[model samples]
Target: MSLVSAVQVRCPSCNTPFTAQMHRAIDATKEPRLKELLIQGRFNLAQCPQCGVQSALSAPFIYHDASKSLFYCFMPMNMGGSAIQQQQQIGQLTNQFVSSLPPEERKGYMLQPKLYLTMQSLIDDILAADGITKEHIEAIKQRAALLQDIAQSQSVEELERKVKESQDKIDDLFFQTLDDYIAQAQEENDLETAQGLSALRDEISLLTRPEGEIAQQAKQLAAEREEMLDKVINERDQERLRTLISEGRPLMDYSFFLALADRIETAQASGNEIEARRLTKLRDTVLAMIDEQDEAARQSLMQAAEFLRTVIREQNPEQYLRENADRIDDAFFAVLNANIIEAQRRKDENAMKALAAIGTVAASILEEKAPPEVRLLNRVMRTEPEQRRALLQEERALLDDRFVALVDQMISQLPEENADLAGELRQLRDMAIDVRAQG
Candidate 1:
């Protein structure tokens, strides 16, 4: 069996003290026995055990022990004292109550009643005399006991269910009171007050409703937004695809060869041999049609042909020439020569006349009694300085024999006393021999 403690408590209505067990006091509820006693007010609640006269009990009369195992009733001092003094007195009384508990139970009870009583006294002060009825105090104590029992409940779900049931009963009562107030207002023709009260009631009802309905509403809204976003995205994609197809962007052409020639060239440069070969075959097929086309068709096909040829020329020059080098070179040179001739025809008359005069003088010199080589040399000498210098060296080499003979003759003609002229002739002859040897 559990150990229990009991304390004497005065009936608040009659000011008649009586013994009440702590468990019973904490557990007091709205039972028929309690109602018949009508101990629902600080005054006129407690019954006198002898005379049965109910009288008002003063504040600070209720007391609890340290372990909260006992509640006590006592006569309090007059209201002439300061609040601090009253608190001190109550604190001493609580200390005495705790000191009276057994040492084993006193350990957990350390100063709990003092704290509870202090807080309770402050609340009682706030409520003043009008609010602190016996019924209100009893209700608070009962709620505390119910909370304790809920703590011992097996599961959170069970505890939550019980709490909800209690809250729902209170809420129903509140709504009923609000409905009655609104009705009274309406009966008095106070339309404004009635409307205000109805609006307040609606707001309170909404606040108390379950959260699942709100969550479902949010989920529906999000799903609708997602659906609209998907539709817009799909429509935009379709429009983009259509525009690309209409503008000839080649989305349908999966053939790698249909790609731009520059792309093929780049692939070839990057050593993508397979892509390069495929592109080359496709380009050749396209270009082969040019040979079968008429002039107008060929002209219309200029871009495709040029692109194919450019890729081949830049990527594989040898192959390009093997295929169309002769034809392309002939066309290029013809245009080049035509441009040069046109420029020559536009030459100044004075420059032309100067060239003609030089040519005539050259022809007359070629008519001299010179070797054919010398004639050719003289003809070249008019315009070629390098050829003139070469011919002069050749002539000097051939005259070496004559130079030696003339030097010997001049040495003989010199007088025996005129040795300087003989020395000069000898020097000339030696220089000529050196030139011949070098040549």
Candidate 2:
């Protein structure tokens, strides 16, 4: 676990004083996600509740990756201190990290940590250790610059010409890089920049991909969805409708309700009074069903949260997790992740470690029980893009229609807020389909 503590910081936008959590040390082996957040420049970032302003707190921190034998300390130059004072701060951080480890785990390398004056330089070295060299990063930057030029095109002809000229540069990594920029902008509360980047991403996606292919596919999917919804809404059999509602619960989102309302309006506009009345009744029934489902989900999450608290109190969650394996469902994991995020928000190192341990155990259990195709899909999702093809090749037997359908199901079940994940799943789904077809 990392060392976390409370600190007071005033928001740059609103100048509102608020307590922010800061991490002084990070053990990459124990908390890999923290390392990722660090690389993304999101580490120790604080967001103001008053104005939604986000700023990274400039503080001294240590990073350690045991597997890589990589240890580095970061001390911001902005924090004015004498050379001796900086050394003392770094020494204290190093001591804390080394003392937290077991005697056997402590090595000579742990005693001497490399120091960095800036976070960006530290992040670059970290990426280099992960095999992402400076050239690769520079290439991504060039693509970003090209994307900016494309976005600033004076006319449709210029945009098209620029895109065609830089077709070689506009690869999957291009969109990914742009998405990173959008995420950074959004985090900093620069909505205009974020929105612009998003629009540019969409435009680039349309230009680089098969023309009208995505739109056509989306249209077909929507039509099929509409037909299914119509069938469910028009079904007069109470028993059949109940079964349909239960099965189609995932599709009963705000959009689904809005579509139903539109149908009711259309019926009224067409002077179909009886049909309108019937549609209204169906809408009411569906709304009630959704409310009931929401309540059940809320209750389930509450129970899961309480169960996690109990496990944390026990301090030995292995037994509890094993005994209550059946209860360690998606809801439980969702609660677990939420708890970890909240702990991260408050910089509660102990809570984060405990929740992470529980999550690891629960995930292993689930993986053990999952089908081979599911296991392969999980690995594919976790693997880097360039390496996934080889992984799929090794597990080609699992790349069947069933796996593709499973991916589709996941994509469909994801909430609208998880657009990024859904997009990734869609790409994975396409890749799996391609692999299966390669047979």
Candidate 3:
């Protein structure tokens, strides 16, 4: 069960008081989405409605994973509770959690809960349980640190010096780390940093080119280019040829241009001047098409960003959210996220903050405006077990037998592999019945 309760909390930004849902216990076997959010570091994220301030809610939380048999209690070091008191609280919480599970489901591991001094340690352990070693994670972190250092370098001499010292570490992981930083910088609206990292990426790519494979690889590439073009033009394989224009299909690869150049040569060699001219014209058209597409995408992203900026810059952003409730979804978030990164790259702090605020405000409105069924279901899931009976009875008008039957039918349709959902549905049905009885 997910142990959560509503709380009155003041926004850190504008000191605005608001009602927010706070989770005490997250169960992987019950509310899987919470578990996913936890892994994504988005669990307990709250946004202030008045000021649009978004931040993670730092508090004690019990994280339970049945499959991994990992039941850990995370107590934020800032809590400042006595060790003995914290231990007692953990013991009591552990007892309550174990009792909530069926006897058959309760394992010996529940007898003693593992205590993490910090949230980071808890996250590290969770990743470790999934077979990701701490060393590998650390190495990736080092790469990220180095990437930032390179991006923040004052001059090419400094960058070159640093590269000389850490050249061996500039592998795939290093570039990936650099890319991640670029995205992060964009999200924060740090433009200068993004551009700097991008430049560093290109510099590294050039510096790290294989010292001796160029000539041989060039010949190999030329052969591949001619062969592919032979299939596309001579064999007239339209399907194969169409791949060149496909999005993210490496349209900018040197071999792709080589293939077009080859087509021109072949046409001229065959003494077909018209055909040679046509191929040359086609290459120009393809280049133009690529440029046009790139420019169009950039404009679209900027447009979306500007719209978000307008919404956030408003005195009452909630009005905008209410107006465009349907548009504030995953795709919208994605566009906003990309623009945020771009904003950060541009060193646009105001835009970054505005983007963040827009997300928080939009999310709050969307949640508040969710369908009655979704709202009721979430309430039922987050409510205390003891209070659930009364809640169901109170909401019995909406949660009629038809609703229970629908959920019951939903459970029946699940495959045997989805045993967790089946158990959760059963629990929901029983709770609804119990609540209906209270009425």
Candidate 4:
């Protein structure tokens, strides 16, 4: 009997090398189908001995100078019409399956199966370029066929079975081919190719290892994104509150009360029951101020109102503080009295005494011999329209200059950087000069 020379190839899975014997002559009677299948590049599950990964290898039927051969020639003219016919048949079947899905679902459905097939095709392309042995090629073909079956299966059970079978075949083919390729490399002294193939096998093995670092990075990114979103939400809420205050929303003008409510709501939302309860008590204190009808209590409420107005105007300078300037002036004077009361409550004796002295001096002057201009100025300064027109000519004359002087003093006392107040005071001074000229 003649000795059969074995064909060897490298295994992709375990980096082992193995060999399979090449048949010298086709056994037409004993296994006719086997001969045909070998020519057509078809095989069943063949696993790697090292890792049990499945694979398939089959040689393509070719003709060389009127003699049947297992390998195809490089020249296009040497290729038989039968090879082209088989390729076309496979393409048609693939197209038919893809076209069967609905338009909307088609892309997603095809994508999943296509990914597996694409990976397998990449492996085949790499092996084919390396000029792997017939046994390795046949093993790859069997693995590809099994992967195709897995992709096409609709039911989970069918898919699982196909996957297991394909894995088994892949193991057998990869281990056997790897063993043969390593042996061949040693024999031929191709150290570089051996190292490269070994690295590829090692990379495949790493796929089963836990990707803890990757998972941790993903979680960190997610948390950062969530924190950024929360910050944006809080900024939006504060902007809404500012807008409401600037718009002179009636309920929002009570800053102490509104702030209390805001704190309570925020605390509750954050699940801080203790903080929410404390804020609720603060809200009740503000409500009590509004409930009292006495002059002292009303003055306290007015100070809170003026403080709210100041806050709104300062925060949103572009917004108009008052539609009616005269009404605003009267309101300002009324709120001053409230400020004194608030200052007294806080034991601000200096502020209260200073305001009281000013009030006393003004009252004393009213009792003295008043000029017409001074009286008229006093009338104009009054909060009520009836009081303004009740002024005698002599009283108007006497009070006008004093009123201008008072306004100048108040303007000088304001913060130097208060541009809005400075501008308004300048206009008031001009108006006073115009009134004096008319007198």
Q: What is the Cα-based lDDT of residue 34 in candidate 1?
A: 22
The TM-score measured for candidate 1 stands at 0.18
Task: Quote each prediction's TM-score.
Answer: 0.18, 0.54, 0.40, 0.17
lDDT of 4 by residue, 195-232 (tens): 44454444333322246854674466456544433332
Q: On residues 1-439, what C-alpha lDDT tens digit does candidate 1 reach at each position?
A: 1113455666655566675433112111212122112232232244468556654434443333232243443324454578787667656655654565566745543454423333335335323333566566655555545444544556546655655565644355456445545654543334456555665555345445677875675466456544432332234354453343333322212222233465578778999988777656644643443233323333433433343335334555434434543333322333223323322333324434433443343234334544554443334335354454344455664535554675577689887888975785575456556656766
- CA lDDT of every candidate: 0.45, 0.81, 0.73, 0.45
- Comparison by lDDT, 1 against 3, better one: 3
**In angstroms, how far off is 93's CA in candidate 4?**
99
Best by lDDT: 2
Regions of candidate 3 where Cα sits further than 4 Å from its true position:
1-23, 26-56, 80-88, 91-108, 132-134, 154-161, 176-203, 211-439
Error of 2 at 32 (Å): 2.2
Q: Poorest 10 consecutive residues of model 1 by lDDT? A: 23-32
Q: Give the Å shift of residue 85 in candidate 4.
A: 99
Clashes of each: 5, 0, 12, 58
lDDT of 1: 0.45
In the predicted model 1, the residue pairs found to clash are: 13-45, 13-46, 13-55, 14-46, 14-55
Query: C-alpha displacement of 159 in model 4, angstroms?
Result: 67
| Model 4 segments more than 4 A misplaced | 1-259, 293-409, 412-439
Badly placed stretches (over 4 Å) of model 1 are: 1-45, 48-53, 59-78, 82-84, 107-109, 112-439
RMSD of 2: 11.9
